[model samples]
Target: MRVDEYNSFANQLQRYASALSRLESLHIRLADGCRLRAYQKRLAQVTVDPRSAIDSQLVIAVTYDLREIDEVNEIVENLPATLDSETLTLLQKVASGSEHPDDELDAPGREAQYELYLGTMLRRGGIPARHGKPDLVATWHNKEFFIEAKRPASAKGFDNRLRSAVHQARALVRPGIIAVCVDQLVRPADGLMVVKDFNALAPSVDNLVRKFVVEQAHTLRKRLSTNEPVAALLLTARVPARIAATGHSSLGTSIQLHPLLAGSIEAKFASSIIPLFAGSPS
Candidate 1:
């Protein structure tokens, strides 16, 4: 994503606050004492102060909270006037508690959010898509494409997650792509991504993501070699970063496409669809 396109910390916070208020007014059943609600309350207590000393833990929490809110807002804003049962169910799941204790980024809720996020992005890219049985079903150039998104909390579980997504994608009658959020795989230690200037943010983030992708190129190639239905591995990451120059923080997102092979049918499909998802060539 471009630097100017990134949402400011204050903007994201305000967006979340408004979203939370709207949900409350609608009588949506958000979890009692949800961490997201708490994060909003805490963030409201202070303004962005670059020099202010804040706990790294709070920064991490706020970063994830803002990203989640943005995702939820995207999904909500794009929904059709009449809500389908499937979409409603997915929203409810997102509103539920985190899948694991003391961790809001785990499976179930975050996982559902990721699916909706992907669908939203695809639609924004002018591809007709929606969250469904195969995680996502999208149409481009009059052809349907199935997508399966996964968020593995750790590297140890990545293989299994990829395998599962591949299985799901292969079952579909249309072409498929496996999208994985590799945040945990490349995330730095808490508080490590403090940048000094806005100009440096994008390069710093790109370097981190690129380095990881390069290091794992062999492993990724090995894993996707035999997965015929899977046209490509869409690896994505969102890192929480603090900008000392602005005294604020935001999530930096990076996406990379690793095709199964060059000059093949699947590779062509992946190349054509990836620009839509990434908003540019990956």
Candidate 2:
């Protein structure tokens, strides 16, 4: 009511504002890496002008509004839309407790599956192929060899994955072939639950495939090509399947080929040798 009383009230208000600003600064710092919260905290804290002497009063006023029940309600109402769809879905999963957890990433196990499948595919055809780290090791036509697998064509970073696979394959042997496999998902059953979220998971499928097939092939090829017994090949999904070898020079390499869906894997294994020996060598 009096001049001194009004001054005292103003000072008290300013102190409260200062305290609120400090709290907001702390909140902003803590939220730095939190993508969604970071933006919200920033919008709340940004000063219209930082250099002005009266900016402190403005900051205090803003903080007062931001801390109110009404302002908190407003922020909560609009926070979800800015997040990515996948991240939002994950947030929902976290909220509802519906997401599944993986026991392990299982990189090597999948690699072994590719190795066994390639070996079975070639060996059944009497190519004398066996699974080897970095590539398949085979003794076809009295020559030692290596084979690498490449992933399908319609994917990104196939080249980079291929490079790493080649580097890894090189460690195992010299003169290897880098093979790629391109196709739709090839689980034994289309209806089976092979993937948790196929649409979300499809983009990453080829990366793993390349790791399983191409990386191994590149490693084996590098090792075999040095005349120290190495070879590599890529089994890309094609209308007609083919074989390629890159370990040897003039003697060259060969592929005992098979049709993409000639029959069950067992049947194709039996029939592939005819093509290996019968097809003209490159």
Candidate 3:
């Protein structure tokens, strides 16, 4: 879907009060001072005057929180009985940790959200996935696969996060995928990304993702070479952007898959499972 189209749909579908009530129904309550509440207030201010100066960071937070709320709601609705505890625990963590003063990218809330997001995506893709020790686990083609989702706060911490995920996967003794969200790495901190036209949105985001992949290529290759259980690295990023011509705001997302060495058992497993996520969300 086009970026603006997604923004319009999401904005229409997600309302803060409704989302909060849905979470409350699930026994998850957010503190009044939580970052999400702050985002909602910022969103309200923006809605009051669309042409006013926009806070780029607030825009990113609002967009991200909306999608997260929607995804989590769907997860709870379709969740299997066995995963009830796991899902609730993660949700509770997100609710509680969100109020922390230092709850940035490295906060437990962010990590739990990432796990929930991946589990939601996997389930939506027709794979039976559950949240757990390695973050997430799923069954595809009669084989169980583990997934460790990580979102480093900064580029310098990427290696450590990757190693931690690899270790978790190795401990499980199952074929696995290391899923990393590189939004912080790709997103510009100064301001929202501006593209000349709608057509430029995707390529602008893709170029940033490609650059990140290239910079991390050696590290990823070295990890895959030694970690037999890890079949592939899945990198995903979402950047808040605006179209200069139309003055429309949206998010540009990119997802890329990097497989293990050419002729390995792990690589073969990755190939077999790739089809399951063919049309996964951006």
Top of the candidates by TM-score: 1
The regions of model 3 sitting more than 4 angstroms off are 1-5, 9-16, 48-83, 96-105, 261-282
> What lDDT score belongs to each candidate, Candidate 1 first?
0.67, 0.34, 0.66
- TM-score for candidate 3, please give it: 0.81
Model 2 CA lDDT for position 233? 35
Kindly list the per-residue Cα lDDT of model 2 for residues 1-282, writing each as its tens digit.
000001122333344345334434433222334322332343344433354343443333332222221212222232332343422332222111101111122223223323444544455455666443545566665765556654322234344545655666557534555554433222111221122332323223333344445544554344334433223233432111111231110111123232322343322333433343222111
Q: Model 3: which ten-residue window has the lowest total lDDT?
A: 1-10
Ranking by lDDT: 1, 3, 2
Per-prediction RMSD in angstroms?
A: 3.8, 26.6, 3.8
Greater TM-score among 2 and 3 belongs to 3
Pairs with backbone N, CA or C atoms under 3 Å apart (clashes), candidate 3: none
Q: What TM-scores do the predictions have?
A: 0.82, 0.30, 0.81
